[model samples]
Target: MATTPAGRHIRNPQGTGGRLRADILAAAGRILESTGSDDAVTLRAIAREAGITAPAIYAHFADRDAIRRTVIEQTFTQLATVLTTAADTEHEPVARLHVVCHAYLDFAARRPHHYRLLFERHRAARGADAGPAAPDVGSIVGADAFGVLLQAADSCIRSGASTAVDPVASATRVWVGLHGQATLQASLPWFPWPPADRLATDVVRRMADLR
Candidate 1:
């Protein structure tokens, strides 16, 4: 631990600040998942969960929103990694796209809270006038996650496997379909839904024009 000029002790010391920040984020994530609400991820709660004083958090994060934003960014990276790993399991463009779509749905089904947090927060941010905001494609987190679909669609087009001319447009449409399916399935688990793989295959074939 280190002491400031005023003799207040800082729990993280000098070189371990990054670790403390990560701990704070992990604590916040746990609170979010447990309570299923961002309101519960207050600084005091996170500090308590991390076994530190509330003042200690101020040294690492400006406030609760900073920590929450970092958590969301990390979550997006995790999603991108999942999609990339799924896509790597196949070589053919159409098959790769199908797997990636299924992977997207699987991620939602497995982590419903985190998935809901992503879009729910965006909708709250967008206000009613603009409608729900899709992930910001310009941000690094958004680009990394959505870029996987763009690459898969482009591959299909280049390989003569897809009839779509514009990869970006096709990818955007496919993403909308996947998002709709995932959200609906999660919110209405009792609904008679088609097989996930079949739904994903149909989406890829229709949205990307996969042959």
Candidate 2:
């Protein structure tokens, strides 16, 4: 692994071809998370962040968008892991849903940069292409992360903890609420927001109407 001047480690620095590619992606993720802006994710910035020459980045990524796409994918995968882990700890569907909701908020609060890049800035970068006609949650880039919530909502409905007639539609509503809260909280941290735990619970309870 190679350590950048910013003290972030890039794995597999001296390794073979695949390793270099992995390191490049990892480095780009670090830069994206640190900079918290799609505009800062240029190949040159990624190369500097990765502690390699600019040309080395080309070996793995075709352009800035290519690296951003990979980083977005990685971020979503990480989010899915976190949400799944949080939800798996409870047996009751209602409890699991609560945990999952809290986990989503926590992920955004803790990784504001990643959340911004994945949800906010990335969509803006896509411009008109990211309009209402975009693919459904199941086919989106971060579908797995949202899938955790969908599964939790389905389980809640099955267990009679939720009154929603359609699990997917209910899950979509809950997701919309969660995303709004997460985005607003991350964007306006200086505002005197309510207690996170209470707000998260309230959002989940109101959306699922858990019995």
Which candidate comes out best when scored by TM-score? 2
Q: Model 2, range 69-170, lDDT digits (tens) per residue?
A: 777788889999999999889888999999998998888888888787786545643444677655666767778988999999999999888888788888
Tell me the spans in candidate 2 whose CA falls farther than 4 Å from its real position.
4-15, 121-136
| Candidate 1 segments whose C-alpha is farther than 4 A from its true place | 1-15, 123-140
TM-score of each: 0.83, 0.86
lDDT of 1 at 96: 91
With candidate 2 superimposed using the best TM-score fit, by how many Å does residue 50's alpha carbon deviate from the native? 1.5
